[model samples]
Target: MSTFLLEIGTEELPADFARLALPQLEQLVRRDLTEQRLSHGVVTTTSTPRRIALLVEGLPAAAADLEEERKGPPAGQAFKDGVPTPAAIGFAKRCGIAPEALELRDTPKGPFVFARVLERGRPTAAVLAEHIPQWIGALQGRRFMRWGEGESRFSRPVRWLVALLDATVISVTLQGSDPEVRAGNTSRGHRLLAESVTIPSAGAYAESLAAVGVQVDRAGRAAAIRSAVLEAAAALGARPDLPDDLFDELTDLVEAPLLIEGSVAEQSLGLPPEVLSTVMRAHQRYVPLYRSGAASDPLALDAKDALLPRFLCIGNGLPAASDTVRRGNERVLKARLADAEFFVQADRAVPSIDRRDQLARVTFAEGLGSLLDRVERIEWLTDVLLEQLQLGAATGDHARRAAHLCKHDLVSQMVGEFPELQGIIGGKYLLAEGEPRAVALAVLEHYLPRGAGDDLPSSDAGAVVALAERLELLLSIYAKGERPSGSSDPYALRRAGNGLLQILWERGWSLDLQALLRRATAHWSQLLPHFSVQAPALATELAEFLRQRLVSLLEEQGVDGDLVQAVAGEGVAIERVLSDPADARQRADLLAALRASGELAGVQAVVTRAARLAEKGSLDAARLSPAGVVDAALFEKPSEAAMLQVLEQLQPIAAGEGAARYGELARALAASRDTLAAFFDGDQSVMVMADEPAVRTNRLNLLGVLRNQASVLADFSRIAG
Candidate 1:
């Protein structure tokens, strides 16, 4: 066994591209190694901004030999009465064997000529050399470019290549590179701290690079950075705001981790913590330090109190240069914060209401009118949702006020400078202007759950406005005939739909989505006639789109696929699902609970059996009661009467709403297992399909009623046994 290493060095790559390329390179190497029959152990992939490296340990010196049977033309065509033909000669030549070496083999299709060929494996170094260029070419990332009259494309210009097997330099070349990169033992180190270093072997690559100020192990660099940040924050009695995304980017931004502490201007600390943090983290990639015990909650009303007038920058330079790096970062942050303060002062001079009027100049989308028009639509939808939700008059007033001012920040100087501060700045401005706290918070919370796993609005008013805003986006964009298909949701319509359902589920609000959509669609048809399709057709398309999103959301929440299908699948009526998503969510949960508790087996067995037999009857699924449909007088056995008794007990529970009712219905079905079994197979059992037409019809109706009641929970047949 031997170690193999391949490194692709380039001009400083984007942090995100370096992080993304590591896994791609690892996977490519693993797949190719497996295909080549070169078994290996512990494949490691790591990256710095300057290079991506792959190392494989315990690799076999050569791939295993392979023997395969090659099928050829049919025996009759290959050989004519014991004499070899042209087809036989050609087939053997292609197989690299003489015609006499071919043998006749019986196959399913017919007798065919076959050649058993054994291929000798090549040295592992040769295989790696051949695949090195292909692996580099197969890498994918955003904004890859060509450089210096070369046709090659990479995240950055390819400057050098390193390929080795044990201590031997493996021969490899990157085609089309202007510099004509080839494998060698020499590898470059930190741009500022060291020059090129000679690698002794594949196993010594990390040690060699580290000796020259380059940390080649990505995990080691990340761990050192995180530990240093936390320790530095601890020494200052502060907490570092190192989100995972920022941490990963920081790890890739530097080859050697060095923490440089920078100071924030006390005057700049007066800005909202969100603004300060955004400037430090998003713009400058510095980690903000907050007071130890100060709340880090994004929604905290007093979040500004937690922020400290300091930050930590991950510097790639040596410790001797720490003071210079810190001063540079502090100067940069000071200018950014000063610009933010200016934008805030300029924005707050005019009231939020004036900003609302300014929205008329900003187009929301083509053919959808201006931002002001969108605000008006949102206000109208808010009222509609408030009416449907019936959260009370005070909540209604707050929501309407919030909806009116939601887009006011879009035209604000502050938001113009920091697009992410849209709602945060608008709400802060409103609060400063003496608007009611409820109204201000609602404005802020309306953009809750900007993505999956994010927070949802805690206030009723915020929830209402949020729902209305998402609804308007879906309706208008869908009215323009745009739908999210596959990975092409440029408008993020799927996310909007998911957000709507998530808010409803989180708040436990029960609003009829189907009725709300139809109303919104009809209203859109009137308000924007140029983009209109028939209201009913558009409403249906929107509902199905949301339904698909709901299904995905439920499945992601760990609901069984069959149970999700039971409530929102194609088998379930769309009206039933959109009528109250909360109810459908509850039904799916109840079904999963029953399955987990070991009760679904019994209920499913009885319900599925009845459903299969119920197919023969013409009874309506809506008819839960056997009162008029079944003739108790036609019963031929005691089991039949007993089964009817159980059905009668389940009618009220099956006809009711919510999880409690469904749970009761499942219990009742499980309890009736014996009576159903007796009716199907016991001494008192009677044939469901009797010779007499009336008796058969009556028996089938009894089963049909049971099937209908069970379906109130789910289609049991869809469940796996």
Candidate 2:
């Protein structure tokens, strides 16, 4: 057994790329190793701003030796009158055996000639040489770069590579070049802290790197980052308020993490903290610290203490003094914050609502008019939502106001400077101006759940506004033919689509989806004169996106893909679906259960027919039989009577309980078992098809009852038992 080490080193990769590329490299390596049949042990991979490395420990030196048996033509058919046919001779040759050495085996298709192959193990180095390079080529990124006259491209240039098996080098070539690269008993430490270091063995990969200022394992790097940040904060009499997401990213950007504190200028403090931080992090990746509270007010200390201002800059090595880094970072922060403060003051000079109207002049898309037009669509959509959700006059009016004001922040200087804080800034500004609570809250919440696992809008007004925003974005993008294809969601319509579903499902409103779409189309048609797109195509594409959104939502809920296909077979009415995630779950569960029942599985088709007859036969149950008896005279046989009796018992409960139709059918089947057995045992078709019209009609009527019972549960015809 031996260990393997591989690293792809390049000129300092993008900080963002380091975080994403390392895990991908590790995953690709494991996949290749598994595909090669080289049984091994745990593989640890790491990445820094410059390199991706993988080490497979306790791996087998070669693939396992094995015997494989392949069956051939049947023994009897394989031979021609015992003289042996070409098939038998061919099988013998393929197996590297003589005809006499061939074996006979019984197979489902009678006897067959079998061949046993004893395969030899191949060297692990040979396996790696074939698979590693190919796997590396499969890495994914938003973009890749080709370098140095080599046809091969990656997220960045491939400067150097190390691939070693224990003490031996496993040479592999990729792209258009094969350089003198070797996997060795050596690796470089933090580029600034230490030069290349040698490892005595495979197991020493981690310790060797760490000894020279590198945390080779990602987890180790992340932990060191956290500890250093916390320690730096404590020393400054404050605690770090690192954004969880930003923290995760920083962890990935460094190998030997060194957290150093920096300060913001007192003059820059007037700029909104979010604006200042965004400018600092967006360009510098610096963690912004707030002012610490004094201990005199214990609770205040606890709260403001956490808000203390300090800069946590993860660097390659420890700096000489805090004053140097602090002064340098503060200089950059002051310049950026000054620009933001100017943008804010310039923006505030204009009235918020008047500025909002100017969004119409700002193109949201190439020909989609301005943000003002989108706001108009949202206003209309919000009104539709109010009616659809049946909100009263007060809530409806409040929601409309919220939708109208939601994008006001888009024109704000603060929002422009910190785009991520768009909604938050709007909400804050609205509150500052003493706006209604609903309107302020909606402005803040309208962009909720910006990503998967993000929090949803909590208030009714926010919910309405969020839905309007998403629907408008979807319509505008889809109308412009910028739809998502495969993994390329350039417009992020999928996320918007998924977000719309989350809102609808969480709200659980029974909406007339088709009617609303028709309304949306009509509204857009009137508004199209204000834009430059082909209105009809845009409307159609928008409708299609909504339809797909419904299908994805249902499919995600574990609805049978086929059932989703069938129901969406008609089209998804998001309102109807949202009225009940539970209903979809129940229907899917019932259909799935019915499918498993061999006897009741044909219910879909049977029920479809019964429903057709019920519609035509016009069986009126408006009045009960005063006599409390089903006409036994109408029953043609004991089976018919027994099935009728069970139907009579189950019908009321089925209709009243609203339990799934499948449960009723299951009960009907259970109750009528003896009757069905007797019917099948007897002449089931005795009166089923007869010269006597009366007898035939009665028998069909009995079949109708059985069919109707199952139809309510599921369309048995659709079920394939």
Candidate 3:
């Protein structure tokens, strides 16, 4: 066994590309090795800004030999009375075996001639050489470009390549380049430190790079950066706000980590902490420090008590030039902060209401009216939701006010410069202008949960406005006749649908979503008659979209897929799902709990059996009672009457709504397992397919009623036993 190493050195690559390419490279190497019959152990990949490296340990010098069975023509054609024929000789020659070596083998399609062929293994170096070029060409990333006269595309220009089997250099060459790159045993070091570094062996790659001031191990570099930031923050009595995304980018931005502490301008501290932090983190890639015990919730911390006038940044320059780097970064940050301060000052000169009027100049979408028009629609939807929810007048007023002012900041100078601060700046401006705190917070949180695993609105007013905002986007965009097909959701309609369901599920609100969509679509049809929007069809489309989103959200919350299907699958009516998303979520949860408690199998068995038989009878799925459909007079067995008794007991529970009733329905089904079994089998059981047509219909109706009652909880046929 020997170690193998391959390093592709390039000009500084994009941080995101470098982070994403490591896994791709590792997977490619593993797949190629397996395909070549080369067994390897512990393949690993790492990357820095300048290079991506792969190392494999415990690799064989050559791939294992393969034995294959080659089949030829039928036995009768290959041989004549145990004498070699021309066909048998030709087949043996093709398989590189003598005619005597071929043996008769019996197959399903009659006997055939077979030969056992052993193929020679290729050298590991040769295999690596064959696959190395393909691997480099297979890598993918955004904005890939070709340098100079080269036709090959990469995230950046390829400058050097390194490939070694133990201490021997593997012969490989990369084509399609103005300056063709070839594999060697030497790799470049840090840009600011040592130049070229020689790898004496594959096992010494990391040590060799480290000696030249390059930390080739990405995890090690990340650990060093994290420790430095935490220690610096601890010494200064502060906490570092190092988001995972920022931390990962920092790790990939350097070959050697050097932490530099810089001071924020005292004047910049007067701005909102979010403004300062966003500027440092998003714009400059610096980690902001917050004062200790600033606030219990870091997200809600105020400017005065939270932000410290200091930040820490990671650099790849020489340690002796730390002060120079610090001063340069501080100067750049100061200039950006000054620009932000100017924008804020100008924005404050105009009242938020004036900004609201400016929205008329901005189009939300083609044929969808202006931003102000959308705001009006949102306000109207807010009122509708408030009435449906029966929220108090105070909350309704706050939500309406927030909805009106939500888009005002889109035209503000501050938001124009920092597009991410749209809602944050608007809320601060509103609070400064003496608006109610509830209204301010609602405006800020209306865009909560920007994506998956993000925060949701915590306040009632915020929740209500958020729902209205997302609902309007979904309705208007969908009515425009563009749907999110495949991977293309240009208007983020899917996100809006997901957000709507997420808010409803989180708040435990029971508003009928189907009714809301109908009313909103009708209002849109009236507001923009030229668009030719069909109210009912559009409402139905939006409801189905939300139903899909609800199923996805339920499964994401750890509910089993089958359980999710049982509650909200295609078989379940879309009206029931959109009537109350929270109810569907609870049903899924109840089913999952039943499965975990070992009671679901019994209920599923009984319900599924009845549901299958119920299809033979013309009974409505919504019918829960057997009062008129099931004829007790047609019964000939005691089991039939016992099954009818269980259905009667389940009628009221199945007819009800909410989690408690669903639980009761599940328990009733579980208890009826034995009774249902007796009706289907054993003594006192009536044949469901009796010769008497009336008796058969009556028996099927009894099963159909039971099936209908279970349908109230789920479409049991869709559930997996």
- Candidate 1 to truth, TM: 0.96
Where model 3 places Cα greater than 4 Å from the true spot, the runs are 73-116, 296-302, 528-531, 630-641, 672-678, 681-684, 688-697
Off by over 4 Å in 2: 16-37, 59-140, 147-152, 170-186, 227-244, 261-313, 319-323, 478-482, 529-548, 554-633, 636-721
Q: After superposition, how far is residue 669 of candidate 2 from its true place, in Å?
A: 12
Question: What are the per-residue Cα lDDT tens digits for candidate 2 across 12-75?
Answer: 6765776676678778777777766778888777777677788888778788887898888888
Report model 2's TM-score to 2 decimal places: 0.73
- The deviation in Å at residue 63 for candidate 1 is 2.6
lDDT for model 3 comes to 0.90
* Location of the lowest summed lDDT over 10 successive residues in candidate 2: 296-305
Whole-model lDDT per candidate: 0.90, 0.67, 0.90
lDDT of each residue in 1-721, candidate 3, tens digit only: 9999999999999999977788899889999999999999999899999998999998998999999999999999999999989999999999888999999989999999999998889999899999999999999899999998979889999989999999999998889865988899999998877789999999999999999999999999999999999999999999999989999999999999999999998878888888888999999999999999867432342466778899999999999999999999999999999998899889999999999999999999999999999999999999999999988999998999999998899999988888998887888899888899899989998988688888999889999999999998998888788899999999888888888888988999998999999989999999888789999999988888888888888888899999898889887888888888889988898889888999999888878988888899888777999999988888899999999999899998988866799989888888889998899888877789899999999988998999888888888888886
Comparing 2 and 3 by TM-score, which wins?
Answer: 3
TM-score of each model, paired residue for residue? 0.96, 0.73, 0.93
Which is better, 1 or 2, measured by TM-score? 1
Please report the TM-score between candidate 3 and the true structure. Answer: 0.93
